[model samples]
Target chain A: MPGPTALNFSEATSHDMFAQRLPQSKDDSLPQVLAAAVTHLHALIRELRPTQADWRKVIEFLTDVGHASDERRQEWVLLSDLLGASALVEEINSRRPKTATPNTVRGPFFRADVPQLPLGGNISLDGIGETLDVFGRVQDLDGDPIANAEIITWQANAQGFYENQQPDLQPEFNLRGCFRTDTDGRFHYRTIKPCGYGVPDDGPVGKLLRQAGYPLCRPAHLHFMIKAPEFETVTTHIYDGSDPHLAEDAIFAVKPELVRTFEQQGKGWLLKLTFIMVRARRGAGT
Target chain B: MPGPTALNFSEATSHDMFAQRLPQSKDDSLPQVLAAAVTHLHALIRELRPTQADWRKVIEFLTDVGHASDERRQEWVLLSDLLGASALVEEINSRRPKTATPNTVRGPFFRADVPQLPLGGNISLDGIGETLDVFGRVQDLDGDPIANAEIITWQANAQGFYENQQPDLQPEFNLRGCFRTDTDGRFHYRTIKPCGYGVPDDGPVGKLLRQAGYPLCRPAHLHFMIKAPEFETVTTHIYDGSDPHLAEDAIFAVKPELVRTFEQQGKGWLLKLTFIMVRARRGAGT
Candidate 1:
């Protein structure tokens, strides 16, 4: 709060009057709190000291981040993921035991309800690309089988764009699949290897990233937001080992432990994977 | 960073994911940083547990805040002031500020260049409301006038409208004036008692304030941004002692020492005020 003054003076004196953040104060109301926050966050961004032109570019990118959204897809999600915000959120909220599987951003390309399939069923749209087999198993934290658990999977064509984002580059429904773990808690899919690709960069998010000296490409990966009754939903990504962004994925979704190598088998490649879900306790909210 | 396997079940058994200001850490870039911030701010606002209808009202008000901006005014600024951001910025950037003449928000209603007037000349033009004669002397922090200081002032007329905001309600140049301090650091103006008033509530900022249960009115005040050769220019508001919003002028510009009372003096109420400025030194950028 500014105090009043009656100190009538004529000479001018020099003073530097800029503080970056507000001193900690008790919560007064929600709006005051949020406004202080907007100010703080804005101040932090300013400290980045982006060039004026870069600032304009960032604004343009944000405009696209919003423009890129639609009923079935949300580019802002990718924008957030690339900026690492979505992952940051997952990390901050993952207070469960360390052994529990960690969460990741639910990538921009996801649908509300994926069709469930039995074990051994193939979901490849045209079985295009070099023949590849993906086999994965689901288990409880104790390594017990989660018999018949569902495994919903989706990926971009060999070109790296999601089926929804690039319908022209790749056939609709190409490389997208859903399967269920067998009694042994194992599931498999047959499709081509997904290539690393560029995210929509013509939009606001892309513009911002480009202005910030960031890349618009993400490593080749698969999307999985797993949910089972009595267990928490897990949103995550699986990265291909050889992708260039293996080191600097725009979405920051790559983890050393999550990287998997493709194995040569006969005329095709075989990839083996596993997923561990936290089992729900009795009477826990589903 | 988000690790592989987001199925952290151990902690899930005890806590729900919707707890507090959690961070998403995979991306360290600015966009991701802001995204998490939006989530956190949004969550904090939600925790206030406002009603759905109230939320709708806020959305509408914020839209209006944006709509309120046009060729001359910036409603976002008004909202910022109401949210206390303007004052916070001044507090953070205050350079070696003296306690007597603290800093404040340069409200949403300021013009770049004001007409320069001779010392002791009255700048007020309305001549309608209570005949009040505002007499003031300007001095340096050491109590000596360096002379030729610019004192530009603008305020709402008796009807609580700046000349620029309400052309029909206020005559052109009504209650808006600029004067230079004389060799003795003396200045004066005659005008009506500007009233306290509520901010336009149909804009986005107003909606947010209403939803947060914050007041919309700012206390009665006379704005002054003073500058002189070799002196530091200071922009501030001298709030009226009797205004209802004195304790919480939307912009937090109310200073205890700055508030002054008024009393009838012959044909009008006389006000005697003083402003002390710091001398600008060599190489001191104004």
Candidate 2:
């Protein structure tokens, strides 16, 4: 077979030529995404005009990120979250009406097999930290109750470590559980107040953040993935408004609508909020 | 400590907030580069508007790329080269005058331990493939001879396998050597003609190319790193003009000025060329 045309490459022509040479993929979006990525990547290179040594450092950083990721950890996901790519992507893909709860990052500690619990059931197995009572209603945009909605929630302990991160100290699924909304669309659960936590800062992503002088702490928040048959599942977090890190969440995930103040009730804290979900369009798969 | 100001994130505000929250670093360039990266990255995400599934795929791809790289291979480098970022960076950083030889990628197979060889010494240790002679004169941009210039070279065998790739089949350092110019800036050596070779396609980079339908084969070429005191060192490749893959070099590294044809001479092939060097600026480091 004849070779491709011999075209010279300069900074001006490299990107366009690279995009032009991309073979058509069976998946249409693949090529489109690849093309966009190349365009932006080349633009970054052009903007940085990094020395060869600078480029090598980038490669080394990426390699370290890869090496730090495995079954237990996802350094790349952490990187996306830290860079605000994840939150922006979540915003773009999950654009909803004003009434619907905004989607944020699901984070990296979610477990799929948490045991189901009844109303007022406590998810905190260790019973550490100050007590917290969480009561919420699930409703559609029109204020109608959405019964039997599954609310899967998880959070870090008082010390800012997830059960998964402290397997030896915390019980399996501690501060994690699944609850079902009642006929009135009310779901109540009890747990300990979660404190602000730092992302895994020992990895390359953390190293980059430190070198950039960026904070590593995410605000105290409770993850909630609520799914009802006819409504789009919203993977989101409710931030503790009083938490000092709310304003500087390392992930840029805090939305004013998703932040709630924890009222002091008796000797414990009470958090009462409502989750508004958007109905899935007919034939739309969530 | 007081929390940073609370800022709501939307598709439009996320990028700006992320940039604003980045604390000042000790290194000025760190924040600058990061800001540029965030700007471009957010733009790419806005352009693609990839679904959550698509974003997950990207993260997975990066993870796989990282996992596929180690001491024996550099999958990230391959990814960078295939995407044309490396070549662009080379072009941007090594912008020399028109008279100087252009710099290309140094590739990953170069070694510093190859023993220096006398003029006319053969580099083909295995004694395989068609015999060929290469003679070249190293000269300054003004055509003055640059004596004692070091020319470090390496290439795959005629069968398209580097010695390191097939350690058991080919002797160590086969088709690899370092040659220095004589008092007159003349150097010559004998080696077998190199053949086109596929990059390591078994890795994630190769898998990506296969899926994208991009050719994995690089053009037949010999690697060269020419260096001399008081002159900028040039890392480049000289492509075989007749090779069909010249136009489709996997790394987009082929330059028209670097292509040469082997002339038939005494039942062997002869390649005669001149190496042009650009003098380094006073007190400048190579």
- DockQ for each model: 0.07, 0.54
Q: How far is candidate 2 from the true structure (C-alpha RMSD, Å)?
A: 3.3
Residue B205 in candidate 1, Cα distance off native in Å: 5.7
lDDT of each residue in B228-254, candidate 2, tens digit only = 999899899998888877777778898
User: Which regions in candidate 1 have their CA more than 4 angstroms from the true location?
Assistant: A1-85, A95-101, A107-218, A228-230, A247-252, A263-286, B1-85, B96-101, B108-192, B197-217, B227-231, B262-275, B281-285
Q: For model 2, what is the C-alpha lDDT against the true structure? A: 0.87
Which stretch of 10 consecutive residues in model 1 chain B shows the poorest summed lDDT? Answer: B12-21
Error of 2 at B119 (Å): 5.2
Model 2, total clashes: 0
Write down the RMSD of all candidates, one decimal each. 9.5, 3.3
Quality of candidate 1's docking, in CAPRI categories?
incorrect
